[model samples]
Target chain A: SQKIEQNSEALNIQEGKTATLTCNYTNYSPAYLQWYRQDPGRGPVFLLLIRENEKEKRKERLKVTFDTTLKQSLFHITASQPADSATYLCALGHRDDKIIFGKGTRLHILP
Target chain B: DTAVSQTPKYLVTQMGNDKSIKCEQNLGHDTMYWYKQDSKKFLKIMFSYNNKELIINETVPNRFSPKSPDKAHLNLHINSLELGDSAVYFCASSQDLRAISYEQYFGPGTRLTVT
Candidate 1:
């Protein structure tokens, strides 16, 4: 069966530290992978997208690495702040319009 | 200005009732989608429409129906709501489906509670 799993249900990181979240999948060759950030009582907001051909993507204090061979993607937040605390979601998409999302990992940036 | 918006941010109703959630996007995107996020926080695509045409329909129940009046609006109607139907419904849109999987902008989401 095809499945997508995040590293954990919750993660705790100190402020100004680096936080790493992992997403792994089985038996799916997705053309692109996406990361989304959702806050409490809010819908998910798009963060980053990495194609299978691309190894890494970055935006400001955020970075994403994609390894199709390993079927895993890593989302990193450097110099994390309290505002960065949110549920991070991993999604896989193919040629078609459908995308499968994994259960999100909630991150807490403790001050 | 809100790019994507859904009506009635919170809805509470009884079982066996019928309800509708309306969504509209002003981003000028041609493709729209409806997603359901359960208590487990797993987001699943229920239906997708591109330019008023149904493009993707997942293994959703027959009680759930999606309507696209035009390219800018997509509405979800659920008949005979049950306890399992209680979840957060989100509406999202992208620029175009032909693109290399563009990012989606989501609405504020509607939280449906069934009693």
Candidate 2:
């Protein structure tokens, strides 16, 4: 069966530290891998997307690395702050508009 | 203005009842989708529509139906709702179906509770 896994159900980090999240998939060849941030009682908001051909993508303080060979993706947040705390989701998409999302990793930045 | 919106932020009903959730996007996108998020916050795509036509349907029960009146609107109708059907349903839209870089914009989501 096809599966998408975000390695950690929850992650905690001290303020100003970097928080890294992992997403791994099996049995799916997606052209693009995407990340989203969802807060409590709100729908997910698009963060960044990395193509299978691209090894990494960065936007401001956020960076995403895609390793198709290993079937995994890493999401990193630099200088993490309390305001950046939220559940982050990793999604896989093919060319035909099909998208599958993982369970998401809840991130907490303590003061 | 909100780019994507969903009606009835919260719905509470008993089992065997019928209900519907409506979604609309003003981003002039060509594709729409329906997703269900369980209590555990696991989101799964249930249906997708492009240009008012169904494109992908996951292993969803026949009791759940998706309707796309146009490219910007997709509505989900549930028949004989059960306790297992309770979840937060989200509606999303993207630029197009063929664009490899397109990212989805999701609505506020509709929380449905089946008693």
Candidate 3:
């Protein structure tokens, strides 16, 4: 079975520091990977999408890198603020349009 | 305007009850999906529809059925909801199912609690 895994423990970082989250998958090769930010009681909001051929993608202060060889993806939030504290999820989509999501990493940015 | 929306954000019902969650997308997307986020925070895909046609159905139970009347609407109907059925249901949409750029736009989830 295909499975996506992220660091289950919460990530705590200083407000001005960078927070990096990792997502790993096994038993599947996805065409693209997506990152989303989810707050409590709210749905996830799409943040970035990087194709398998793309090495890295960035949006404002956020950056995501995909390494197909390692079957892993990294999400980075630079100069993070307390407002950036939320659960971040990484998702992969296959050629057939089926998507699988990671368990997500809860990030806590302390002021 | 809300791109993707689901109705009745909170549902609290007893076991063996039947309920439905309605989803609508105004983004003119061709593909819509239903996902269940369990208590463990594991998000799993339940079903997907493209242009009102069923495209992918994951290993979901037969008690959960998805109905799509049009490209913009996909509804999930769960029969005899069990205590294990308590979870957050999310609806999402994308422009094209086959497109490599499958960045799904998600709606506010419906939290179902079966007691």
Candidate 4:
């Protein structure tokens, strides 16, 4: 069976600081990895997707790094703002399989 | 316009009853999906439809069925809902199943509560 894990504890950082979240997987070689943002009582919104061949991807203040050798992906939000507080999820997917999501890491930005 | 939408945003029903959640996507996507988020906030895929054809069905019970009238619509029908069935159901769609860059757009989600 394949399993994905993220930090279970809530990550708190001051505004304008960089916040890094980790996603680790075991027993699966995904073709692509994705990150999503989810607010309370709302569906997840796609943030970024990185292919197995790609090393890193960026969008605005968000950046995602994929290290297939380590079976991990790191999501970083630079100069974070209070409005950026939300749970971030990492997803793994192959060509023939549906995307699988991790439990997610809750990030809180303190002013 | 809302790219993806689901009807009956909030559903509260008793155990043993039956209900359905309707989903529609205006993005003209060829792949549609149904996902369930549990109390623990774990998101899991229940079903996936491509061009109105069933492509992926997870280890979901037979009590849960997904119907697609077309490429842009997918509806979920649950029979004999149990207390454990309470969760938020989300509908999503993507451009095509074979496209590697296909990114899913999600709806607001339907919160189902079985008392």
Q: Find the candidate with the highest DockQ and give its number.
A: 1
Kindly list the interface RMSD, in angstroms, of each predicted candidate in the order they appear. Answer: 1.3, 1.4, 1.3, 1.4
User: What DockQ values do the models have?
Assistant: 0.77, 0.74, 0.75, 0.69
Q: Which segments of candidate 3 are over 4 A away from where they belong?
A: none
List the candidates ranked by DockQ, beginning with the highest.
Answer: 1, 3, 2, 4
CAPRI tier for the interface of model 3: medium
Show model 1 residue runs off by greater than 4 Å.
none
lDDT of 4 by residue, A17-97 (tens): 999999999999999999999999888999999999999999999999999999999999999999999999999998867
Instruction: Give the DockQ (C-alpha) for candidate 3.
Output: 0.75
Q: Ten residues in a row with the worst lDDT in model 2 chain A?
A: A92-101
Q: Which tens-of-lDDT digit does each residue in B46-84 have in candidate 4?
A: 999999999889999999999999898999999999999
Q: Which lDDT tens digits does candidate 2 get at residues A1-111?
A: 679999889999999999999999999999999999999999999999999899999999999999999999999999999999999999998886578899999999999
Off by over 4 Å in 4: none
Error of 4 at B57 (Å): 0.8
- Residue A80 C-alpha lDDT in model 3: 98
Q: Candidate 3's residue-wise lDDT over B8-48, tens digit each?
A: 99999999999999999999999999999999988888998
Between candidates 3 and 4, the TM-score winner:
4
DockQ of 4: 0.69
Q: Which whole-number lDDT from 0 to 100 does residue A78 have in model 1?
A: 99
Docking class of 2: medium
Better of 2 and 4 by DockQ: 2
TM for every model, in the order presented, reads 0.98, 0.97, 0.97, 0.98
